[model samples]
Target chain A: MTTDAAVELAGVTKRFGDVVALDRVDLRVPSGVIFGFLGPNGAGKTTTIRLLTGLARPTSGEVRVLGREVTSAGFEVSSRVGYLPDVPAFYEWMTGEEYLAFVASLFGLESSVAKKRAGVLLEAAGLAGVRTRIGGYSRGMKQRLGIAQALMNAPALLVLDEPTSALDPIGRKEVLDMIEALAGKATVFFSTHILSDAERVCDEVAILDRGRVVANASVDEIRSRAGRKVALEVAGDVERVERAVAAAAWCRGVTRVGARIEAAVSDPGSAQRDVPAIVAAAGAGLVRFETVEPTLEDVFVELVERAS
Target chain B: MRGFRPFFLKELREIARTWRIWVLPSIVVVFALTGPVLAKVMPEILRSMSSEQLGGAVISLPEPTWKDAYAQWVKNLTQIVTFALVIMLGGTVASEVRSGTAIMVLTKPVSRPAFVLAKAAANAVLVTATTLLGAAATWAVTLAVFGEAPLRPIVQPTAAWLAWALFLVAVMTLASVLVQSPSGAAGVGIGVYAAISIASLSRWAVEHTPAGLIGAPGALLAGDRPPLSWPLAATALIAAAALAGAAVLFARKEL
Candidate 1:
């Protein structure tokens, strides 16, 4: 594990009964980076979170958090990692303050410090006024409380499993804001199927498919690899333009329907180079021309599909 | 100790919120309060039955004493209250894992052994309190009915009973640690109990062996055959060892 990396998994494998949940997976998340774990359901996102947080042991391979081996130094690593499960549950009998206080004490916080921290965290998570029983909390409020508890120790790494999956749009935005705010100070390894949520907050991402990480790179790197897609709506001879686009050197594939033409291009740079020539050669009158950037969603679907 | 304090408090709170605390105590208290009254009144009711309704039943009845009431209380406890407790808290440890609440705790700096120990301590305290309440209630009623007819002889038996209760709870903790669900834990616990009982039934020297620790309430307060000091001692040691085993298992188990 590098000193700069908050979490590192080297060829980790985990199995549940007959199912291989995670297989030879490797991930390295730098300290103070918002790392997105993007995968569809059952793509081993939660399994990775459990392994990183020391909630579950890997069937084989090594896991390190905060530069310490997980199984052997779990206590040391866990003391520095705060985790929120996909569905966080608190002792229903407790109030928000009480629950956070209990979590703080588990981290060996002094009573005065724990209370002060809990108060500040509850406020930060937008749960300040919700002093009632946790059982009475709405799903969103519970999620907010989950965030509050996860950040209780101000851990070096914060692992949130599908933090925004079950939330409404507003709730999702709130969690994203909390995650974004933690950047530059704490390493955030957030797992989610919500690509928009990842795009909204993550600095780096790993797209997992079928118990393996298919793509691990920064948001920019993934977008760069996916390339850009250009959609052009032309007024004339769509079939002629399609034939012309098929022979264009800069384009990968082109499809047309009635007046609309969409092309997967080699590069956005080349789109400017080759699009006009193709349009002029076919003599098509273009109504609209637009360039679309690849999003985290596209990258996720592509990786999952390619892996399968 | 910090984690144990908070976790134990949390466990107690769970017992309070759920039906576990009220269900068994209600049954035991009801049985305790009604035992003397039922014993006192049952004979008269039997005598009042018409000959045809009685179907040629004998008319004369034995006087209802505190001994009879105590007997009734013990019978009800052995049959119902203890069983309710076992069924209710059977999955205390398993529920946390199944519900993923254990994730919240294990991710903290607290040790897994502390987690298991806290749960065991909380369950032990709660069970002991309720059982003692039932015992005291029974004793009070029996005293009022039978004029305190030398109840000291029962104290040793009651102590032995408490020991077995501790043993039962230790086994439940072991079951809870081993299984992932409450129903699974209860099944394992009951199976452990049955295996022990069947073993105890054998007339071999092993029957009287400390392995008799497996038969809890039955082995505790059976007869003038006093609680075996060696067996009781052995069971306590084994129960402690089992609890330690559970702690070790939970420490290594994936949440």
Candidate 2:
């Protein structure tokens, strides 16, 4: 484990009977940053989170959290790690405040400290003054309380699995904001298939696909490495323009939508020079021709497609 | 064990919030109150029915005693209380696991043994309280109706029943850990109870197995001092084994 890494997994292969959930998966989450585990559904993201949280053992390798081997350290290391499952379930009979207090006590916090911390976390989770039973909470409210409970110990590493998967846009924003607020205070390793959520808050991301990590880099690096997409809006037959652009060796893929043509280009410099001439040769009046920055979604799709 | 106190308190709070605290004790108390009243009235009701059937010919009946009252209480416990215990605790661990609540708490600093032990302790405490309250109520009612049921017979039998209840809880706990569904756990618990009851008919099991513990109370009420030490010790050992087994299995279980 690196000195700065909050979680590290080396050659971790978790298999259930005949199916492999995670195969030789290696990942490192640095301290004090939001590391997004980005993958589509069934891409081993939750499996990775479970391994890191010590809820399940690896079939064949080592997992370390907060510099302690999870398999060997047991609850000692668990004390330093806070985890929220994909669907966080609580005692529905308990009021939100009571549940949080109960969690605080599990961490062996003093009574006064537990009370103060519960109050602060409740406010931070946007659950302040909500004394209703958890059974009465909305999906979003339950998620927020889940986060609050996970933070009761002020843990070194916070693991959240799809925290925003089922929330509304407003609720997603609320959870994302809470995750963002943890920057520099605790290392937040959250898993999500939502590219926009990761793009908005993640400093680093690991793209997992088919039980393996396809890419692990900073968000900016993935965006840059995915290269630029060129958008050409023309006032002629879009099919003619698309063919002209697609024939070019530098253009990776092209999609035509009515009067506009969007082409992913590997060599942006050459494509920039050639696209205009191709549009002219095709007898199309070009309305707009510009290079657009690649989104995390594009990188994710490209990596997953290529890996598959 | 770490986090036992908080977890145990949480279990207690859950019982109270879910109304198990009141409902279970109320069931026990109702049975207790009805025992002595039924014992005092049954003979008179039988005599009246016999006289009516015999065309007003007088019929005499043996007077009811405190033993009858205690016996009624024991019967109610073995039937109603046992059934209630199985139903109430069948899902104790299975529901938590199925709902993913176990994952939430198990990821914290709490050890698996502590979690299992705390739940067992909370349930034991509740059952003990209910048993004592029911016994006290029965004692007062029996004294009023039967003119002084000796404390020793009532208290001893009640203690034996309490031990058996704890043993059943332990069985349910182990079954809950072993099975995925609450119904399955209940089935296993009831199966174990039935097996014990059936096995008690064996000649060797009469004096050797923990099955004898459940029958000790009735034997004591019948003025037969059944040897209780071996069966009680065996029940304690088996209950401890079940709880310990649950903890060990849960520790290795993948949440």
Candidate 3:
């Protein structure tokens, strides 16, 4: 792996019985970026996490993390990689402090070191002074503890699986904020179906659909892929205007549904020229014309729908 | 250390807050106290009932003995305590999956093998403690009621019980690894037990093969006359190890 690549998957394939959980897929996560793996459930998000963390091996592929092949993966990367499972499981008997200490022992840390580090992590994750048993912790508190455990070793790459799915609105915000705060300290590759969480924290994202990554790029690169769309609600003669707009070589795909005309244009500058001429020639009264930029949710939904 | 300590402690906490911990112990304790009392009084009670119906007819009944008291305790364990033990440990991994708790631990640096091993070790400790406590209580009560017959060396029986306890723990661990829900694990655990029991019953395997570990515990408890051999002891130990290994392998297996 290159110094810039915190995680790299080359032609990874995972099969579950007869079903293909992940197809021959490749993903790259550069250093110091919060990368989001956005897909609906069973879209290979968890499978990818399993493969990367060595929880499960890929049927055929290579996974490299922190400049090492994941062949001896388990605890090697565990120290450098913190993971928050989609719904983290914990020992309800432990207080937040005790739970962190248990995770620290996995790293072979001294008792004093583990306790000190766990104390810092608990406070950082905003779980300080919570003396209740984990059984009594709210879903949000559990998620916070999950984050704290994942980050306990001061890992280089933190992989979280749908960490915010169970949290309330405010809780979700806090978790996302915690992730964002760790941007420079660790590389986070978290999977989420919640687009807003990804939008809030992720600088990079991959859209997985049907066991393959349909779109993998920086947030801006994907936003740029679908280009821009101009929607027009003309008062009269929409078909004539759509036909006129369709005849323009610059307009890529044009569709007319009732009075609303939608066209995918490569350049908004060309639309500035064609829209007015068509409306004037067809004697159509332009009710509203608006340019809509694609959102991560829109791109994700469109990509998944098109791939399937 | 990894997921095991955290997960094990978590289970202990769950047992404390819920009614299950109290319920399981209370039931065991009740059986322990009642076994000897029931044995001594049952024959006379039945005789009195018969005399009342038959108008004071002379009736002879077999006197209850120390053997009967121990037999009653074994029967309770085989029929009821065993079921409860299976239920308690069956959900070790299942409840985590259902609650989305497994996701949190497995995604960490903790290997799936360690997770399964931790569970096996923890549940084994809990079950063994509970079983022995009940056994000890019953033994004490038997001494109090029967005035202590010549104490026989119990080395072999103690070993067998320990083996059985470990076997139960391994089986329950395997069950948890195979299913995503507690109910699913319990069903599969029963199915596994049934399969092993059926295998042990086949005359072809019992005479020529080392498969009797599955059946020997019950056979011995039921008063079957068989010499205790090293092969039988080894079979239990090996089976326990194999089941634990399988649990580790399956827990690490991808979902």
Please provide, for model 1 over A144-163, each residue's C-alpha lDDT reduced to its tens digit, 9 standing for 90 to 100. 99999989888889999999
Model 1 achieves a DockQ score of 0.70
C-alpha lDDT values of all predictions? 0.80, 0.89, 0.76
lDDT of candidate 1 over B1-255, digit per residue (tens): 337777777778777887767776788788977887788788878887845586877688778876677667666765565567667667778988877788789888778888888888888887778777877887887777777744554454455556767777888888899888898888886676667666767654234444444343333344445336677767778789989999989888877
Clashes within 3 Å, all models in order = 0, 0, 6
**What's the lDDT for candidate 3?**
0.76
Tens digits of per-residue lDDT for model 3 on A46-136? Answer: 8888777776788888888876777665566766888877777776767898788777766667898888898888887788888998989
Instruction: Report clash pairs, candidate 3.
Output: A80-A155, A88-B104, A89-B101, A91-B10, A92-B10, A93-B10
Worst 10 residues of 2 chain A by lDDT: A1-10
lDDT of 3 at A113: 85
Estimate the TM-score of every prediction.
0.92, 0.96, 0.81
Clashing pairs in 1: none
Stretches of model 1 off by over 4 angstroms after superposition: A267-270, A280-283, B50-52, B55-57, B202-207, B210-227
Model 3 chain A: ten consecutive residues of lowest lDDT = A70-79
Q: What DockQ values do the models have? A: 0.70, 0.88, 0.39
Q: Please write out the lDDT profile of model 2 over residues A1-308, one tens digit for every residue.
A: 58668888899999999999999998888888899999989999888888887788999988988888888896778888888998999999988999988888888889999999999999998889987889999999999999999899998899999999999999999999999989889999999999999999999999999899999889999888786889989988778889989999998888888898999888889988998899899988889999899899989998999998
Candidate 1's iRMSD: 1.7
